[model samples]
Target: MTAVVALLRAVNVGSRTVRSAELKAVATSLGHTEVVTYVNSGNLVLVPADGASPDDVAAGLSAAFESQYGFAVPVVARTAAEWELVVRALPFRAEAESDRSHLVVYCWDGVPDVASIRTFDASVYGNETVIWHGRETYAYYPDGIGRSKLTLPVLSKAAGRVGTARNWRTVLALQKLAQERS
Candidate 1:
Protein backbone atom coordinates (compact mmCIF):
# COMPACT_ATOMS: atom_id res chain seq x y z
CA MET A 1 0.00 0.00 0.00
CA THR A 2 2.20 2.79 -1.30
CA ALA A 3 1.15 6.34 -0.56
CA VAL A 4 0.46 8.62 -3.50
CA VAL A 5 0.30 12.40 -3.67
CA ALA A 6 -2.39 13.57 -6.06
CA LEU A 7 -2.75 17.16 -7.19
CA LEU A 8 -5.89 18.28 -9.00
CA ARG A 9 -5.49 21.27 -11.27
CA ALA A 10 -7.66 24.39 -11.24
CA VAL A 11 -10.11 23.24 -8.63
CA ASN A 12 -11.91 25.45 -6.10
CA VAL A 13 -10.94 28.35 -8.31
CA GLY A 14 -13.51 30.31 -10.25
CA SER A 15 -16.69 28.37 -11.00
CA ARG A 16 -14.89 25.05 -10.93
CA THR A 17 -15.51 24.48 -7.27
CA VAL A 18 -14.76 21.18 -5.52
CA ARG A 19 -15.62 20.77 -1.89
CA SER A 20 -12.97 19.11 0.27
CA ALA A 21 -15.41 16.62 1.72
CA GLU A 22 -16.64 15.55 -1.70
CA LEU A 23 -13.06 15.19 -2.87
CA LYS A 24 -12.32 12.89 0.04
CA ALA A 25 -15.45 10.90 -0.66
CA VAL A 26 -14.46 10.39 -4.26
CA ALA A 27 -11.04 9.15 -3.21
CA THR A 28 -12.55 6.82 -0.64
CA SER A 29 -14.99 5.43 -3.19
CA LEU A 30 -12.06 4.56 -5.38
CA GLY A 31 -10.75 2.16 -2.72
CA HIS A 32 -7.87 4.34 -1.53
CA THR A 33 -7.27 4.18 2.20
CA GLU A 34 -5.90 6.64 4.71
CA VAL A 35 -7.15 9.45 2.50
CA VAL A 36 -6.14 12.89 3.59
CA THR A 37 -6.68 16.24 1.94
CA TYR A 38 -4.68 19.34 2.70
CA VAL A 39 -6.61 22.56 2.29
CA ASN A 40 -9.34 23.16 -0.34
CA SER A 41 -7.09 23.35 -3.36
CA GLY A 42 -7.10 19.62 -4.13
CA ASN A 43 -3.98 18.35 -2.38
CA LEU A 44 -4.51 14.69 -1.50
CA VAL A 45 -2.50 11.92 0.14
CA LEU A 46 -3.69 8.34 0.21
CA VAL A 47 -2.79 4.68 -0.09
CA PRO A 48 -3.94 3.14 -3.37
CA ALA A 49 -5.98 -0.07 -3.35
CA ASP A 50 -4.48 -3.26 -4.77
CA GLY A 51 -1.02 -1.77 -5.07
CA ALA A 52 -1.98 0.51 -7.94
CA SER A 53 0.78 2.57 -9.52
CA PRO A 54 0.87 6.28 -8.97
CA ASP A 55 -0.07 6.91 -12.60
CA ASP A 56 -2.97 4.51 -12.36
CA VAL A 57 -4.18 6.13 -9.17
CA ALA A 58 -3.95 9.53 -10.80
CA ALA A 59 -6.00 8.40 -13.79
CA GLY A 60 -8.61 6.74 -11.64
CA LEU A 61 -8.91 9.78 -9.41
CA SER A 62 -9.24 12.12 -12.36
CA ALA A 63 -11.93 10.03 -13.94
CA ALA A 64 -13.82 9.58 -10.70
CA PHE A 65 -13.63 13.29 -9.91
CA GLU A 66 -14.95 14.22 -13.31
CA SER A 67 -17.76 11.73 -13.10
CA GLN A 68 -18.76 12.85 -9.65
CA TYR A 69 -18.46 16.59 -10.21
CA GLY A 70 -19.50 16.73 -13.87
CA PHE A 71 -16.28 18.53 -14.75
CA ALA A 72 -12.88 17.33 -15.81
CA VAL A 73 -10.09 17.80 -13.30
CA PRO A 74 -6.62 16.95 -14.42
CA VAL A 75 -4.61 15.11 -11.79
CA VAL A 76 -0.88 14.70 -11.38
CA ALA A 77 0.26 12.04 -8.95
CA ARG A 78 3.58 10.85 -7.53
CA THR A 79 4.66 8.17 -5.15
CA ALA A 80 5.82 9.15 -1.68
CA ALA A 81 9.41 8.41 -2.67
CA GLU A 82 9.11 10.54 -5.79
CA TRP A 83 7.59 13.37 -3.78
CA GLU A 84 10.57 13.26 -1.40
CA LEU A 85 12.88 13.69 -4.36
CA VAL A 86 10.79 16.65 -5.52
CA VAL A 87 11.38 18.33 -2.18
CA ARG A 88 15.11 17.67 -2.33
CA ALA A 89 15.36 18.89 -5.92
CA LEU A 90 13.65 22.23 -5.38
CA PRO A 91 15.88 24.85 -7.02
CA PHE A 92 14.86 27.88 -4.93
CA ARG A 93 15.50 26.32 -1.53
CA ALA A 94 16.89 29.52 -0.07
CA GLU A 95 14.06 31.62 -1.39
CA ALA A 96 11.53 29.03 -0.22
CA GLU A 97 12.94 29.20 3.28
CA SER A 98 12.77 32.98 3.27
CA ASP A 99 9.46 33.58 1.44
CA ARG A 100 7.65 30.34 0.78
CA SER A 101 4.59 32.04 -0.68
CA HIS A 102 6.63 33.49 -3.51
CA LEU A 103 8.22 30.20 -4.41
CA VAL A 104 5.94 27.61 -6.06
CA VAL A 105 6.43 24.17 -7.50
CA TYR A 106 4.47 23.18 -10.59
CA CYS A 107 3.77 19.50 -11.10
CA TRP A 108 2.91 18.23 -14.57
CA ASP A 109 1.32 14.98 -15.71
CA GLY A 110 4.62 14.06 -17.28
CA VAL A 111 7.98 15.67 -17.94
CA PRO A 112 7.49 18.72 -20.10
CA ASP A 113 9.51 19.30 -23.22
CA VAL A 114 13.00 20.12 -21.98
CA ALA A 115 14.06 21.93 -25.13
CA SER A 116 11.10 24.30 -24.96
CA ILE A 117 11.73 25.07 -21.32
CA ARG A 118 15.40 25.69 -22.04
CA THR A 119 14.65 28.20 -24.78
CA PHE A 120 12.03 30.18 -22.91
CA ASP A 121 12.71 33.91 -22.61
CA ALA A 122 12.29 34.38 -18.90
CA SER A 123 13.88 37.85 -18.98
CA VAL A 124 10.53 39.31 -20.00
CA TYR A 125 9.11 38.31 -16.63
CA GLY A 126 11.60 40.54 -14.74
CA ASN A 127 13.56 38.92 -11.91
CA GLU A 128 11.42 35.77 -11.91
CA THR A 129 13.28 32.46 -11.90
CA VAL A 130 12.08 29.23 -13.50
CA ILE A 131 13.88 25.92 -13.36
CA TRP A 132 12.80 22.52 -14.61
CA HIS A 133 13.76 19.36 -12.74
CA GLY A 134 12.24 15.93 -13.27
CA ARG A 135 8.45 16.31 -13.59
CA GLU A 136 8.30 19.52 -11.60
CA THR A 137 9.11 23.17 -12.32
CA TYR A 138 10.30 25.48 -9.59
CA ALA A 139 9.42 29.17 -10.02
CA TYR A 140 10.32 32.08 -7.81
CA TYR A 141 8.49 35.38 -8.04
CA PRO A 142 10.68 38.02 -6.41
CA ASP A 143 7.93 40.61 -6.78
CA GLY A 144 5.16 38.23 -5.72
CA ILE A 145 3.12 36.15 -8.12
CA GLY A 146 0.21 38.55 -8.37
CA ARG A 147 2.52 41.39 -9.43
CA SER A 148 4.72 39.33 -11.70
CA LYS A 149 4.26 38.92 -15.45
CA LEU A 150 5.17 35.23 -15.32
CA THR A 151 1.65 33.86 -15.18
CA LEU A 152 0.68 30.20 -15.29
CA PRO A 153 -0.41 30.42 -18.89
CA VAL A 154 2.95 31.84 -19.90
CA LEU A 155 4.89 29.15 -18.09
CA SER A 156 2.61 26.42 -19.40
CA LYS A 157 3.08 27.65 -22.94
CA ALA A 158 6.83 27.59 -22.51
CA ALA A 159 6.89 24.19 -20.92
CA GLY A 160 4.54 22.70 -23.54
CA ARG A 161 2.24 21.29 -20.83
CA VAL A 162 -0.22 22.62 -18.31
CA GLY A 163 0.47 22.03 -14.61
CA THR A 164 -0.78 22.81 -11.14
CA ALA A 165 1.20 25.10 -8.80
CA ARG A 166 1.54 24.79 -5.05
CA ASN A 167 3.48 27.12 -2.78
CA TRP A 168 6.64 25.85 -1.13
CA ARG A 169 4.95 25.50 2.23
CA THR A 170 2.10 23.40 0.82
CA VAL A 171 4.60 21.34 -1.13
CA LEU A 172 6.48 20.49 2.05
CA ALA A 173 3.27 19.79 3.95
CA LEU A 174 2.00 17.41 1.29
CA GLN A 175 5.35 15.67 1.29
CA LYS A 176 5.20 15.19 5.03
CA LEU A 177 1.65 13.82 4.88
CA ALA A 178 2.50 11.39 2.11
CA GLN A 179 5.64 10.29 3.95
CA GLU A 180 3.68 9.63 7.11
CA ARG A 181 1.11 7.56 5.26
CA SER A 182 3.77 5.61 3.41
Candidate 2:
Protein backbone atom coordinates (compact mmCIF):
# COMPACT_ATOMS: atom_id res chain seq x y z
CA MET A 1 0.00 0.00 0.00
CA THR A 2 1.32 3.39 -0.98
CA ALA A 3 0.66 6.34 1.24
CA VAL A 4 -1.02 9.21 -0.57
CA VAL A 5 -2.05 12.73 0.23
CA ALA A 6 -5.38 13.74 -1.29
CA LEU A 7 -6.20 17.41 -1.47
CA LEU A 8 -9.79 18.51 -2.01
CA ARG A 9 -10.34 21.75 -3.84
CA ALA A 10 -12.39 24.66 -2.54
CA VAL A 11 -13.84 22.91 0.44
CA ASN A 12 -14.86 24.56 3.72
CA VAL A 13 -15.05 27.79 1.79
CA GLY A 14 -18.25 29.53 0.80
CA SER A 15 -21.05 26.93 0.78
CA ARG A 16 -18.89 23.88 0.00
CA THR A 17 -18.30 22.64 3.51
CA VAL A 18 -16.86 19.16 4.09
CA ARG A 19 -16.30 18.07 7.64
CA SER A 20 -13.06 16.26 8.47
CA ALA A 21 -14.88 13.26 9.87
CA GLU A 22 -16.95 12.89 6.72
CA LEU A 23 -13.84 13.27 4.62
CA LYS A 24 -12.10 10.47 6.51
CA ALA A 25 -15.22 8.34 6.19
CA VAL A 26 -15.14 8.81 2.45
CA ALA A 27 -11.54 7.62 2.28
CA THR A 28 -12.21 4.67 4.53
CA SER A 29 -15.20 3.72 2.42
CA LEU A 30 -12.95 3.69 -0.61
CA GLY A 31 -10.85 0.82 0.87
CA HIS A 32 -8.05 3.07 1.99
CA THR A 33 -6.34 2.09 5.21
CA GLU A 34 -5.02 4.33 7.95
CA VAL A 35 -7.24 7.16 6.78
CA VAL A 36 -6.50 10.48 8.43
CA THR A 37 -7.60 14.04 7.79
CA TYR A 38 -5.60 17.09 8.77
CA VAL A 39 -7.31 20.37 9.51
CA ASN A 40 -10.80 21.16 8.15
CA SER A 41 -9.70 22.19 4.70
CA GLY A 42 -9.97 18.70 3.20
CA ASN A 43 -6.45 17.36 3.58
CA LEU A 44 -6.55 13.54 3.67
CA VAL A 45 -3.70 11.08 4.19
CA LEU A 46 -4.27 7.41 3.56
CA VAL A 47 -2.72 4.21 2.33
CA PRO A 48 -4.63 3.01 -0.70
CA ALA A 49 -5.71 -0.63 -0.90
CA ASP A 50 -4.09 -2.98 -3.43
CA GLY A 51 -1.32 -0.47 -3.98
CA ALA A 52 -3.45 1.84 -6.10
CA SER A 53 -1.72 4.59 -8.03
CA PRO A 54 -2.06 8.17 -6.93
CA ASP A 55 -4.17 9.10 -9.95
CA ASP A 56 -6.52 6.18 -9.38
CA VAL A 57 -6.85 7.05 -5.70
CA ALA A 58 -7.58 10.66 -6.56
CA ALA A 59 -10.32 9.73 -9.04
CA GLY A 60 -11.92 7.34 -6.60
CA LEU A 61 -11.77 9.81 -3.73
CA SER A 62 -13.25 12.61 -5.81
CA ALA A 63 -16.13 10.42 -6.91
CA ALA A 64 -16.78 9.15 -3.40
CA PHE A 65 -16.61 12.64 -1.92
CA GLU A 66 -19.13 13.96 -4.44
CA SER A 67 -21.44 11.01 -3.87
CA GLN A 68 -21.35 11.62 -0.14
CA TYR A 69 -21.54 15.43 -0.19
CA GLY A 70 -23.96 16.03 -3.10
CA PHE A 71 -21.42 18.32 -4.70
CA ALA A 72 -18.40 17.95 -6.95
CA VAL A 73 -15.18 18.07 -4.97
CA PRO A 74 -12.12 17.81 -7.17
CA VAL A 75 -9.16 15.96 -5.63
CA VAL A 76 -5.43 15.81 -6.37
CA ALA A 77 -3.34 13.01 -4.89
CA ARG A 78 0.41 12.66 -4.60
CA THR A 79 2.45 9.78 -3.27
CA ALA A 80 4.58 10.37 -0.21
CA ALA A 81 7.74 10.33 -2.31
CA GLU A 82 6.37 12.86 -4.77
CA TRP A 83 5.30 15.03 -1.88
CA GLU A 84 8.83 14.97 -0.51
CA LEU A 85 10.12 16.22 -3.82
CA VAL A 86 7.50 18.94 -3.76
CA VAL A 87 8.86 20.15 -0.45
CA ARG A 88 12.43 19.94 -1.69
CA ALA A 89 11.69 21.68 -4.98
CA LEU A 90 10.00 24.68 -3.47
CA PRO A 91 11.38 27.69 -5.37
CA PHE A 92 11.18 30.38 -2.75
CA ARG A 93 12.98 28.79 0.19
CA ALA A 94 14.05 32.06 1.80
CA GLU A 95 10.62 33.57 1.44
CA ALA A 96 9.03 30.41 2.78
CA GLU A 97 11.35 30.40 5.77
CA SER A 98 10.45 34.02 6.44
CA ASP A 99 6.68 33.76 5.92
CA ARG A 100 5.37 30.25 5.31
CA SER A 101 1.81 31.54 5.20
CA HIS A 102 2.55 33.70 2.20
CA LEU A 103 3.98 30.83 0.17
CA VAL A 104 1.45 28.63 -1.60
CA VAL A 105 1.80 25.40 -3.54
CA TYR A 106 -0.88 24.60 -6.09
CA CYS A 107 -1.15 20.95 -7.06
CA TRP A 108 -2.81 20.14 -10.37
CA ASP A 109 -4.69 17.03 -11.42
CA GLY A 110 -2.07 16.47 -14.10
CA VAL A 111 1.06 18.04 -15.38
CA PRO A 112 0.09 21.30 -17.06
CA ASP A 113 1.81 22.56 -20.18
CA VAL A 114 4.59 24.89 -19.19
CA ALA A 115 4.18 26.94 -22.37
CA SER A 116 0.56 27.59 -21.56
CA ILE A 117 1.41 28.53 -17.98
CA ARG A 118 3.91 31.04 -19.30
CA THR A 119 1.19 32.81 -21.23
CA PHE A 120 -0.19 34.11 -17.95
CA ASP A 121 0.48 37.81 -17.54
CA ALA A 122 2.16 37.95 -14.16
CA SER A 123 2.71 41.68 -14.59
CA VAL A 124 -0.92 42.27 -13.78
CA TYR A 125 -0.51 40.76 -10.32
CA GLY A 126 2.31 43.08 -9.27
CA ASN A 127 4.88 41.40 -6.98
CA GLU A 128 3.27 37.97 -6.84
CA THR A 129 5.54 35.24 -8.21
CA VAL A 130 4.37 31.97 -9.81
CA ILE A 131 6.66 29.13 -10.82
CA TRP A 132 5.51 25.84 -12.32
CA HIS A 133 7.38 22.65 -11.53
CA GLY A 134 6.21 19.22 -12.61
CA ARG A 135 2.59 18.89 -11.46
CA GLU A 136 2.88 21.64 -8.88
CA THR A 137 2.92 25.41 -9.08
CA TYR A 138 4.73 27.43 -6.44
CA ALA A 139 3.42 30.93 -5.81
CA TYR A 140 4.72 33.53 -3.42
CA TYR A 141 2.31 36.26 -2.38
CA PRO A 142 4.36 39.23 -1.32
CA ASP A 143 1.20 41.14 -0.48
CA GLY A 144 -0.46 38.05 1.01
CA ILE A 145 -2.92 35.93 -1.00
CA GLY A 146 -6.04 37.70 0.21
CA ARG A 147 -4.92 41.09 -1.04
CA SER A 148 -3.40 39.87 -4.30
CA LYS A 149 -5.04 39.75 -7.72
CA LEU A 150 -3.41 36.41 -8.52
CA THR A 151 -6.31 34.34 -7.32
CA LEU A 152 -6.80 30.62 -7.89
CA PRO A 153 -9.39 31.22 -10.63
CA VAL A 154 -6.96 33.34 -12.60
CA LEU A 155 -4.16 30.78 -12.21
CA SER A 156 -6.48 27.93 -13.14
CA LYS A 157 -7.58 29.79 -16.25
CA ALA A 158 -3.99 30.42 -17.21
CA ALA A 159 -3.00 26.81 -16.71
CA GLY A 160 -6.17 25.50 -18.36
CA ARG A 161 -6.79 23.15 -15.48
CA VAL A 162 -8.26 22.98 -11.97
CA GLY A 163 -6.08 22.55 -8.89
CA THR A 164 -5.95 23.09 -5.14
CA ALA A 165 -3.63 25.42 -3.30
CA ARG A 166 -2.14 24.83 0.15
CA ASN A 167 0.00 27.20 2.10
CA TRP A 168 3.63 26.17 2.67
CA ARG A 169 2.91 25.18 6.24
CA THR A 170 0.04 22.92 5.23
CA VAL A 171 2.12 21.47 2.45
CA LEU A 172 4.90 20.48 4.82
CA ALA A 173 2.44 19.13 7.36
CA LEU A 174 0.80 16.94 4.75
CA GLN A 175 4.18 15.70 3.65
CA LYS A 176 5.12 14.78 7.19
CA LEU A 177 1.83 12.98 7.73
CA ALA A 178 2.14 11.00 4.53
CA GLN A 179 5.70 10.08 5.37
CA GLU A 180 4.66 8.84 8.78
CA ARG A 181 1.89 6.74 7.30
CA SER A 182 4.14 5.40 4.60
Give the Å shift of residue 11 in candidate 2.
Answer: 1.4
TM-scores for the candidates: 0.96, 0.96
Cα lDDT of model 2 by residue, 33-147, tens digit: 9999999998999999889999999899889878887889899999999999999999898998798889999999888867888787776888988898888999998888888
**In model 1, what is the error at residue 120, expressed in angstroms?**
0.6
The 10-residue segment with the lowest total lDDT in model 1? 90-99
* lDDT of the candidates, in the order given: 0.89, 0.89
Error of 1 at 24 (Å): 0.5
Clashes of each: 0, 0
RMSD of 1: 1.1
lDDT of 1: 0.89
What is the lDDT, from 0 to 100, of the residue 142 in candidate 1? 84
lDDT (tens digit, per residue) of candidate 1 on 77-111: 99999999999998776887788889989898888
